[model samples]
Target: MDWIEANFTDQAGLAALLLAALGPDGDDGSHDRSHLLRVWQNATSIAGREADCDRAVLTAAVILHDCVAVEKDSPLRSQASRLAASRARAILAGLGWEAPRIDAAAHAIEAHSFSAGIAAETLEARILQDADRLDAIGAIGIARCFYVAGRMGSGLYDPADPPAGRRDLDDRRFALDHFGAKLFRVAGNFQTEAGQALADARTRTMRRFVQALLDEIEGKSE
Candidate 1:
């Protein structure tokens, strides 16, 4: 218990420091501060029952997960995990965190991304992964898609033009294509039951939204 307290104390302090460093731009209403908070909340909810999970590690990873996002020129396209890991290590060390715990937390943070290609390796990582994926689905996911798409100067949907094969698809592609390409694929990647359920449910909602958009384009929906 004492060990948990000590390790977790350091983890919490480091997380707070990173959050402070991140400041306002990290709250741009697109997977920003509040979104991180929600991911923390969601991770806690699912991870609480798993005895093998470390609450402190999971919490810290969730909060500092996107710290490097602000540093990137284009977060959606750039792989910021390496930068995030570097920043996370420094932040943890500044808070007096030992090598092992800091290393674990940093690894978890780096592995939490869906685009980063480094899959979840631990139960704690899995929880963080699910929580982050949840944010990329459902209502919040929809909002974030547009927010990011707008940031990247993408269109909402292209009625007349079809997906111009794989070679031409870039950031300029519509927000709707993201669902077909990635968002809809999240459910299959989730490692936990809670994540799977949320992904399944969110995928349905997204499908409905996509179908409705098509209906509207075809003069079917009101």
Candidate 2:
């Protein structure tokens, strides 16, 4: 029997496969093991409420979603999902997955990207999209935004127009501008009811944080 079959009865097999696919070191902290686990939890929770979703496919998709590392602002950023999908197929196939199951997982991975903007064609795909996108919002999302910005050498905000006034929204130059460019828009266009509900709460958290900053700038705290 192949390694997949040998380990078929063991639950840890899935985790082992996903870990290998994620690369030896697991990740570089940004889209690391913790991120994948969070996405997995989110996907499974959404799957519980969604009808007609294949839990196995959704689980595999969540684990393999970020298998390949790509720069956040690379010209190929949007293609990361497509690349990951392609990689997922090979890994699933190696693990003795049937063609249809592999296809379902690959489809979910392909359609989960925000930049790719691909429409999901299956319930599993929709849930995966919603699950992954959820990670990009709320308190954790806010931390990630500044983390990436700092990595890219961006300023906190434009000093001349700190509250995003009188300046074009440019996330590449100012970390604060990302709220207008992307973060603030996630809640309004979710694919599932659960995703939307959670996103709304997270969106509010983000807005409150931004408002506090604005209030401080305007001396409203006094």
Candidate 3:
């Protein structure tokens, strides 16, 4: 079965806006279809533990969270979520969704962005933010770190000081620097209790990986 069929039991409610939800297909793997799928999976697991979540609202928010494409270094990066939220409202309105539900989805989409620096007011908004942050840590997060680095033409790490001891942390130049720049700090940003727990564990995994990667870079065994 395809991902939607396997991960989600029923999608009858979302079928109408499914295409619009996918947004403009982008070449950025970090924010691609698989990313949306993973976020949905994360949101589902978290939502099951949280109280009174609206599945359709959460699903719509998850799918369209990244509708507006913005690069990591783009001048418009901080506004990406707002742009996507605006677009999401329009898309759902076209689907003839009620005002309240569309507003819920829009809030979730906008607040999900770390760059936006906005608080997630509702349960779905908090869940979406946490769910998206979940994908930015752990084993998968490690892979994406280097993947994005390669795309940005940044090195894996500083050759002389892998820990970035002397010089300032420059993630734009070194992928490893990102752990300090953002990854290590995201655990505390999780909103829901379940999401915070999962984030703590994933952040631990990332810590271990970072130490090991540094050890390998320094040619230290064990």
Best by TM-score: 3
**Residues forming the 10-long window of minimal summed lDDT in candidate 3:** 2-11
Candidate 2 off by > 4 Å = 1-13
Please provide, for model 3 over 15-123, each residue's C-alpha lDDT reduced to its tens digit, 9 standing for 90 to 100: 4356545646699999987898888889989999976988888989998898888988899999999999999898878866779989999999999998799999999
Write model 2 residue lDDT over 152-181, tens digit each, in one string: 899988878877777789999998899899
Lowest-sum lDDT 10-residue window in model 2: 2-11
Our model 3 lands, by Cα RMSD against the true structure, at 4.3
Could you tell me every candidate's TM-score relative to the true structure?
A: 0.85, 0.91, 0.91
Off by over 4 Å in 1: 1-18, 70-78, 161-171
Better of 1 and 2 by TM-score: 2
Please state every model's RMSD to the true fold in angstroms.
3.3, 2.8, 4.3
**Pick by lDDT: 2 or 3, better one:** 3
C-alpha lDDT of residue 62 in model 2: 87
